[model samples]
Target: MGPEGGGDALLRLEGVSKRYRRSGLLALDDVSIWVGAGERVGLMGPSGSGKSTLACIAAGLLSPNAGHVRFDGVERSGGGRLPRGRSAAVRRAWLGMQMVFQDPEASFIPTMRLGDAVFEGARYLPRFKGADKDRLVREALEAVELPGSYAERFPYELSGGECQRAAIARAVIGRPKLLLCDEATSALDVTVQAKVMALLGRVHRELGTAFLFIGHNPALVGGFCDRIYRIGGGRITEELEACERP
Candidate 1:
């Protein structure tokens, strides 16, 4: 099933469930959610409430134990895997979506220059085929409010906030249709969080990309999303609209 209230969604999770085999812990239970094209959706919960688990599943980084994940009308069921010959399907799944993690510094390779790190994924994108690496890296950095000079620096050289902005630059450079941000701003101070949020807002507006903004902070999520869903104990406890956010 698609999202309630109209237009075809870019991503949909229907009755999805996940459980860790090692600890025998249920991280998600019958979770259903959707994000429409260019829509901003928020998933909010406390720590250990299955927030990151759901994000990982939605992004196809992890498989759900049950239920279906639909992206752009294609469906991937529980425990499903893309077959070896399905190159197009694989490309659709990967190139159209991107994820940003909580720790920006850890997201990159310490040995690589920031410019190469940011352009690595994007270079394979069809739109950037034959595109100049330096130009793409500079433009991506500029979009994230970073100077082009910073691209020569390594991940260790940047502050947390700066590194996060670079991560955002890397994620957006590919022009992904959906961006899954898992605790993207939690590591930053209040002021830096605001700035990062503002940068995200600009990215969304300019690129018209849909977002699944996952975090523990209700205030931050509510401020950025059009709709909010609250999860607790591995289940969705509440759904809040932008106007109804608390």
Candidate 2:
């Protein structure tokens, strides 16, 4: 089923469930959620509440034990079976979605230059070579409020905030229709975090991208999301309109 409020939904998770075998613990049980095109939703929970697991399943990185994930009304990859030889097609569809991790430092290769790192996944585009790639790299950096000169510097040379912005630059350059941010701003200080959140708001408004923002901060998520879902005890305990939250 699609989201109830009536716009064309970009992603839907129906009766989704997942469990880990080692301890036979259920991480998510009969979870259902949908994200409308250009909508921003936030997921909040205490640690070990399956927040990241939900993100992994939503991003097609992990298959759910049961149920379905749909993107644009068609079933997505990872959480369900695909038609023969259509796995690549599913992956291609996912190319328009990106995930930003809690720790940006862990997502990048220490050996790769920041520019190459940002443009790595986009190499498939025929026009993405030479000067064009350079131009994009510069534009992406600037989009994240980073100076152009920072592109040549490696990840280690950047501060924590800069590294996180670089990770965001990588996701935005792909021009993703959906961005799954898993604690993307958690590592930064309050001021820098605000800046990153503002950047995200600008990107979403400009590109019409839907954001599934995952974080533990109620105040932060309250300010940026259209709705908030609280996960606890392996289930969504509450759903609140962003403006109505106390």
Backbone collisions counted per model: 0, 0
Per-candidate TM-scores read: 0.93, 0.90
- Please identify model 1 stretches exceeding 4 Å from their true place: 1-7, 77-81, 244-246
> On residues 82-150, what C-alpha lDDT tens digit does candidate 1 reach at each position?
545666756566567889999999999999999999997597777777888898899899989899998
Provide the clash count, candidate 1.
0
lDDT of 2 by residue, 92-164 (tens): 6767778899999889999889998999757654445554788889999999999978889899999999999
Worst 10 residues of 1 by lDDT: 76-85
Candidate 2 Cα RMSD after full superposition onto the native fold (Å): 2.8
Which candidate achieves the best lDDT against the true structure?
Answer: 1
Q: What lDDT score belongs to each candidate, Candidate 1 first? A: 0.86, 0.84
